[model samples]
Target: MRLSLISSIRRPGFRVRPLLGFWHRWFGLFAALWLALMAITGSAVVYYEELGSWLNPDLRQVEVINPALPPETWLGAAKAEYP
Candidate 1:
């Protein structure tokens, strides 16, 4: 079966050439457009974080405070605030 398939491909006839040509033309025609779209989407995904930070600079640039304060401090703060 493999031999027959390979032989048929190698033989090259009107049928195979036209079929291959049609597929080649169609795929080639769409390849550039598909690649451009893929490139744009890929770049967007890669720079998503940077883009988000650019849009919301304040939120992204805020300082991160240490939350390792003593338990007593937390309890006192919570009680003072809630009570």
Candidate 2:
């Protein structure tokens, strides 16, 4: 039975050939549209940080910081900032 099914698919002028072609074209068309949307969404996510800074100018400002602070002092500053 399986051999007959396989032979039917490979046979010339069989109904299965056109059915397979129709499915292939349908899937390819939908896949292309899905791929395009994914590509655009991926690009937006990849530049999310830059886009966020561009949209919110306040986040783009820089401040000078003292990097020489000790670990304990940094921990205290972090606690104060969060608390």
Candidate 3:
């Protein structure tokens, strides 16, 4: 009776064409979301160093030249320390 009709619709090997379209649509939607996420994160990584320096400028500062011992004195220290 009515059960036979419902069984035929739900039978094995029955092709539901609309579900195929829905599957493809959802796949495309998720792919686009993944792509957008990658693009945003990629941009953030590319600018990470600049962003860090800007946020903490004190850590990126260069001081004026300071007086130092002569090269001979540095070489003597190096010889004593390394050799």
Candidate 4:
């Protein structure tokens, strides 16, 4: 028996709507994942210094001197050297 065009065609019941719906669902899932990744990384960038300091408190700490000079005295010394 000879095959007709309609009979020879594969997936006779295939429709555009279902195919598009499948693609849409996957696209939305991937887009949501990418957005979440960007948001997390962006927050990390915004708080880079704080994150580093929190991770290494000893390295970020500064030593304090008891007898620190006043700002006026430092300014006078700087002006004398420059002028």
Highest lDDT scorer: 3
Q: Residue 74 of model 3: what lDDT?
A: 96
Candidate 4: lDDT of 81? 100
* Model 2 lDDT, full chain set: 0.90
Expressed as tens digits, the lDDT of each residue in 1-83 for candidate 4 is 35676567757677778889999999999999999999999999999999999999999777897779999999999999999
- Which predicted model would earn the best TM-score? 4
- TM-scores for candidates 1 onward, in order: 0.44, 0.52, 0.53, 0.59
Sort order, lDDT high to low: 3, 4, 2, 1
Candidate 2: which stretches are off by over 4 Å?
1-14, 58-83
Residue 57, candidate 4: Cα error in Å is 0.6
Return the TM-score for candidate 3, rounded to 2 decimals.
Answer: 0.53
Off by over 4 Å in 4: 1-12, 62-83
Ranking by TM-score: 4, 3, 2, 1
lDDT of each: 0.87, 0.90, 0.92, 0.91
lDDT of 3 by residue, 1-83 (tens): 89998987796876789789999999999999999999999998999999999899998988879877899999999999999
All candidates: CA RMSD (Å): 8.0, 9.1, 6.3, 6.0
3 or 4, which is superior by lDDT?
A: 3
